[model samples]
Target chain A: METLKIVKIGGNIIEDETSLNAFLKLFSNLEGKKILVHGGGKRATSVALKLGIESQMVNGRRVTDAKTLEVITMVYGGLVNKNVVAKLQALNVNAIGLTGADVNSISSEKRPIKEVDFGFVGDVKKVAHESIDKLIQADFIPVFCAITHDGNGQLLNTNADTITSQVAIGMSKLYKTSVYYCFELNGVLENIQDKNSVIKHIDSKTYKYLLDRGIIADGMLPKLENCFDALKNGVNTINMGNTDMLIKANDNFTKITL
Target chain B: METLKIVKIGGNIIEDETSLNAFLKLFSNLEGKKILVHGGGKRATSVALKLGIESQMVNGRRVTDAKTLEVITMVYGGLVNKNVVAKLQALNVNAIGLTGADVNSISSEKRPIKEVDFGFVGDVKKVAHESIDKLIQADFIPVFCAITHDGNGQLLNTNADTITSQVAIGMSKLYKTSVYYCFELNGVLENIQDKNSVIKHIDSKTYKYLLDRGIIADGMLPKLENCFDALKNGVNTINMGNTDMLIKANDNFTKITL
Candidate 1:
């Protein structure tokens, strides 16, 4: 059997109804194998603000303090996860929405990055592919939120891209397949402002050269790093581009190579 | 100071974009006291079907088996809650999406109903209205999911109507205000098919008469019961009718009287 395809949707794609519906329509036609992982930082930030709570962000990652964690739990684990599942259903896709804590499907440890006490932030350490595989075998697509459990059984907020990459790598190792990072942008661009300036392909060396030249900044840096990591961890092929472009195998995507 | 009004929306209201937007528009203008509690049983049922998990219902209540519990968590607590919050936000209304388990704000105990093991279903035993009131005071509408936590700290899926009623009753006592159950229908009818044949008002006596006459059946029964319960719990007024009628105090609604 072919290994499953793991797709990661950024906060930008999942934030609005139009993009969400578009993604769902494409998702409905997806054949073979797939799993979806989504980010909820933007939604979380908006909710936090409404509640008069100031979100603390350090280097684009949310500083998940106790109060922020509560907001995140409501926004990510409770809100965004279901929204995606509902959209998938509206498109007639059989999607099973899940959090890592649900069945211990994804396990992690408190990241505590850079000695900053980011309360409940997690770094995913294990992916229970077998359970997810069973659901997929039963023809249900697993729609995952980026929350996970520390091995000692505490709920922690993990980065969505990291979680998506971990799941893709885990699935690839289990079945030896490829993983694709799908977003609103048309792959890694040679020039950020120009739509037609997408870099068609890049080796590990070229990717580092672009990063060194300051071509990737902000969110895209982490995304490219995640792609690089996924490739290292048994994932044979990694593609990053617009969701529709990926579905149609359009020439507007960047294929990361060894 | 005048007491704040807490308006609770049923899951039926939040099922689609048109109804949701309609409710939000009406809600936006109604300044003063407001809180939103929504149902997700319909969406949960649809998701359960898609996942090949049979959702068993006993006495019109979802018999949330383990798998069904998972589905409800993702659908009701996650998807439906966020969508409502987002819609409210888009209208520039500060809305905070929350689950009962988020801050131990709403606590319950799982009461296995009539020998059926409704895996994680809960009956509302206690509600901490202070936190919710604070949010309302800050001009933030707290949108809640019907999932609650057992005092011992287990998440139990509760009926949205029951939860909304409890929250309304609790808030009414604390703030001494009215709670309105707004729907698409004109209110409880003498006949379901005849829209104009609305029961103008009902008390305990008329409530029993309608039940005995078999006018109120199925899902409408619980809503009526909840309305009566809220009235009994010292809520000053209970309006059961269409959104426009409730907002404008239109004469077409069936007011539940003491």
Candidate 2:
């Protein structure tokens, strides 16, 4: 199987112009097949406020009502995705922007109302691996926004981290896929306030020890769990870091393994 | 050569919920390989107003300043394009949404500054016909919005009619292509007020007479000119009508020719 790199970027880099340009320049230089997954940040909230749509959240997760979904569809799928693609094109990389709805690339089921009604949020149920593989084989880079469709004319807001994991797992059938969760942090830090306390590696034993020590809790727990899920599946390797780790061999990141 | 249908739709149908759905249904049912080109209407203007971006128009064409371009990218490329593609998917059509930046499908040069610095607008320079052909051959429907890229990290506002013509001309190399300009009007009306005054056929001679008599003036003039240009450049046929013309054989439209 050929090697493929799948990178997921969150709000921190996306909202900053300088960081986005610098990161995109390095991403454009990555060799072989690559996929980019992006998360919408405060832009959606600000745009919603401007449009007079009030955003609702439960447990730090957005409740994607119809209006909020429309805002995200416009911001994440449109502004952010196209901007990244255009920049990549400037560097001679053939990039295609996509949502789950395009070419039925990914399909999801609306999250059922269990305790909290998350409105139009979806849990990914399927990935069109064959279709995406064809795109990669044709030398086109796929830039995905965190919006999906139900295959029934409904677009749903989804989690970018989960999307990255699912897509990496799907493509693992034909390629040795490595998934990177790229954000502002250098890596998983032992001391939350210290950027230098990056955890270099976390095997299952180390993961258990970190959890027992109560160092890795809350949001970081879910993210690490998602990475572990991908690793346990078919994804070859998983890394969490800033953009520089992808370009240079730096230990300022967290590498996950069984 | 295989037959290809390229349809361009304006704002009338897009702004209306019921009408847009009906048109998308008809579009999905159309036989053979097809491409859809869409225009963003008052939605961009309204959204701009909300975002505090002032729109400038010169000779009825938008003066796309940097701010205006961002709004349109959000509206046209994001909101409208995704909605259309998702609807088509519900009808079981394999639909993919595209901007010129995606897959480098289309490339343009920023319109050089003359009297008006129409900020970030672009003139169509090249179309990646081969990449599009591969997509069509793989049984995917390409839905395009009126946003293009300069191949240099900039997304430019473009005329939807010109995008339609350029794409039709580009695809004419490998397929027998027809371009349909679908909008509010049934066809070219002999009398502007009478809905039943549609002219059934128009050749170069008839078109000249219409212009000479001040009949095909203003907006219709540029549309007809684009049609003629496409016909002269190997496009097999061109039609102007409502959505119904695409579904059934109806004489309530005008056919253009040399």
Q: Number of the top candidate by lDDT?
A: 2
Q: What is candidate 2's CA lDDT for residue A31?
A: 83
* Residue B142 shift from truth in candidate 1, angstroms: 28
User: What does candidate 2's lDDT look like per residue over B1-258, in tens digits?
Assistant: 999999998988899989899888888888989999999989999999998888888877679898888899999999999989999999998999999999998899999998878889899999899999888887889999999999989999999989999999999999999889897788999999998799989999999999999989888888788788889998988989888888776668988877
Tell me the tens digit of each residue's lDDT in model 1 across A120-216: 8888888877756665665667788887766453567888878877887778756766667776678888888997788888779998888899988
Each prediction's TM-score against the native? 0.52, 0.95
What is the Å distance of residue B60 in model 1 from its true position? Answer: 19
How much lDDT does each candidate structure score? 0.72, 0.90
lDDT of each residue in B1-258, candidate 1, tens digit only: 366666767767777768878888888777776777777747777656755788787767557787777667766786566556545655656565666654345778888657666777889998867655655554556777888766453567887777777887777757766667777788888877898888888889988888998988998887777777778887777777877754665678877877
Residue B175, candidate 2: alpha-carbon lDDT: 96
Q: What is the number of residue pairs that collide in model 2? A: 0
In angstroms, give how far residue B49 of model 2 lies from its true place.
1.3
Residues A1-258, candidate 2: write the lDDT tens digits.
899999998888899999889888888888888999999888999999998999888888668898889899999999999999999999988999999999999999999998899999989999999999878878889999999999999999999988999999999988999888897788999999899899999989999999999999988998888878888889988988899888765667988887
